[model samples]
Target: MGAGLARFARNRMALFGAAILLGLLLLVLATPALFPGDPFRLVGPALQPPGGRFLLGTDTLGRDVAAQIAYGARTSLLIGVGATLGAILFGVIVGGLAGYYRGAVEIVLMRVTEFFQTIPAFVLAILIVAILSPSVTSEIIAIAAVSWPGIARLVRGEFAALGGREFILACTGLGASDARIIFRHMLPNCTAPIIAVGSLLIGTAILIEAGLAFLGLGDPNVMSWGLIISAGRAVLRSAWWICTFPGIAILLTVLAINLVGDGLNEALNPRLRER
Candidate 1:
């Protein structure tokens, strides 16, 4: 673990990405204290450009763009983390069961996973959100529902490979129960790949949430980056700042997450680290 951490820290791009993500988290946490004004309330004239008064300027409804972004960060992080965690939970359970008990269970689980994989993820998420009535909870569920199959496949493969290993057989020989072997031994060994995949999944979840928000499927009460862009699209020609800032936020965030994910993959893979 220490070696992996050292290797990850040595990656310049990953370090840079981590710094950016940390900064965003700090900014999100400090928003209420630093910028106490309401993000949803009208603060100035409509469609104002970046100026001395409003750092990122005001939007179509005269709400501060910077405030909106600060608040939006909270929403994005919430949905991304929440959705990914949900997906991981679902994937791990399905994959672990299928991999450990590999017979009819594996066949059925893999087929079900493949069914989800056959559907376009974005379209599936949209359908789920629409059906669930478009709240933050629904968005999280929608994204998780669409995203879990990939994780399930990854975990299933890991478990299938690991299940036949000497260590697992030794545990079985020691009279360990299936649940104990799966959770206590196999799962811990599988953690590195899971972490790498989960990091990437977070970025995917964020992108899915943003896309949903842009399509007007976001929670009406939340100030999200996609919602900001959607609201600013009508006056984009005149008020480019309104949309541009939030778009940049999304781009930077996703890029940072990808970089970190890549770093994690390299660091966690002993073969890659050795190379």
Candidate 2:
């Protein structure tokens, strides 16, 4: 673990990404204590621009924008992490099976995967959310349902590639069970791609959650960046801070996640490994 950390630290871009992500996560975790009173507390006047009392300003509802943003970090992180975990779990299981076992099983699973892949994730998430009602739980489920196909396909490819290696055949010759071979041997080799994809998926999940909230399909009780943006849209001309701050938060987060993912991809499987 220390060596791994050292390697990660050596990559400046990845380290920067990690720092940003960690800081954001810590902020999310500490929001409750950092902000006094409720995020929805109408202590200030509505549409108050940035000033002495309200640093980031207040929304039309007289809520503190900075407080709301702090609370929003929690919501966005929760949704993003939750949805990504769901996708990774289901995608790994399904993809592992389809890749390890050929014949009818692979055909059926791949066909289902392909079908899901054909539909646009945003549209599918929207349809699912619409059916399930507009809430955070429904939104997470919707995003998870649509997000797994790409990961499944990537996992399948990785598994298939690993399967052809001589070491796998050697394990087979030793009379190892299929389960052991797949789980112990092949799965370990798939870690590089899994880690890389997971980083990217986190960003995608955050974006999806934001979009859902923007469309009014978010948790009503929670303070999310998307919800703030949505609320600000109506008073954009007068209360630009409503949307501006949250939008900036979202953009920075997504960019940081992508940078980390890209850096990890390059670091984990260097050009030397390809040779």
lDDT by residue for model 1 over 25-64, one digit each (tens)?
9999999997796789998898888988999999888899
lDDT of 2 at 55: 92
Ten contiguous residues with the weakest lDDT in model 1:
266-275
Candidate 2: deviation at residue 250, Å?
0.2
Once superposed on the true structure, which residue ranges of model 1 sit more than 4 Å away at CA? Answer: none
Task: Identify the runs in model 2 with alpha carbons over 4 angstroms from their true place.
Answer: 1-7, 270-275
Clashing residue pairs in candidate 2 are: none
lDDT, model 2, position 250? 95
Candidate 2, residue 114: Cα displacement in angstroms equals 1.1
lDDT of 2 by residue, 168-263 (tens): 999999999999998899998888778888879989999999998998888888889999999999999988999999999999899889988887
